[model samples]
Target: MKAWQHLQREPGSAVADPDVLQVINACAPRPSPTLMRINGRVVIAYSRTRAFIDRDAWEALPSDGLLLLRVWPRGTSSSWFALTRPELERTFDEVRKTRSWNSVRHYHFRVFPAALEAFRVCMTRDEAPFASQISAAEAGSESEKRGSPVSPSH
Candidate 1:
């Protein structure tokens, strides 16, 4: 069954990747109890705008279970689908003609084997945290790093 499991204030599991784990970290408010069982199928989302699955939650999934992931490009009609192996070849043939990474504003991913493995090994690296206040020097440096203008008040 598909359900939206709300994250807890404290993590129910440590096996999830740290960034994914951060969805329930001390700094963030817990929305609800985490689903511990991966029976059949389960999914966890961060917010309505954008989210990815928790690795620990993914790990709990029975390996043999079938997975299907669909990604939609923001402001575009084209959608990407990745099904289990037997259906993958056909999906790829379809993807080649329509998918363009450079045009993607937002992406949706399917959580089957190859995609899951990629998420496991290629999750995002550490990013700078946002602060309530930024000094002139800090803002200037950040602007240089991003190759864009950053104001101290930002």
Candidate 2:
């Protein structure tokens, strides 16, 4: 991003206190630390089909807060949609545009607050993000079991 480019240009200069929000894309190998100058926290992740698993971790940040979108720009892109230069400039806005009736993916990973224990409780060093898609199917089954009057849109 522009901020990283700016910082890269001035390697010796004292970087400002971080005000960052991090985003790790799907199938990412790892989160990049260079993009995390603002707020100085990492938020590498993949969103589940129906939810942002880390939602409560940063529920209070605004859409435009600083972000470190950790997507692949080399080789095959790990993100469902790789961001272009113009899109990165307005990533939050562009990501919000991806919102729809059943989609939970977007580039709106701005705001890097200190890590929350609640957010880490379910995850461990060995577990992978989202873990699996069985939950999505389970949700549908549960809905059927409840016999809700309105059917799911999907």
Best by lDDT: 1
Can you give the TM-score per candidate against the true fold? Answer: 0.21, 0.21
Estimate candidate 1's RMSD in Å: 20.1
Per-residue lDDT for 47-71 in model 2, tens only?
Answer: 2222122222223223333222233
What are the Cα lDDT values of the candidates? Answer: 0.25, 0.25
Give a tens-digit lDDT track for model 1, residues 57-150: 2333343322222232356432121122322232222332334412432223343222222222112344212221124324453211001111
Candidate 2, 26: how far from true, in Å? Answer: 21
Each candidate's root-mean-square deviation in Å? 20.1, 18.5
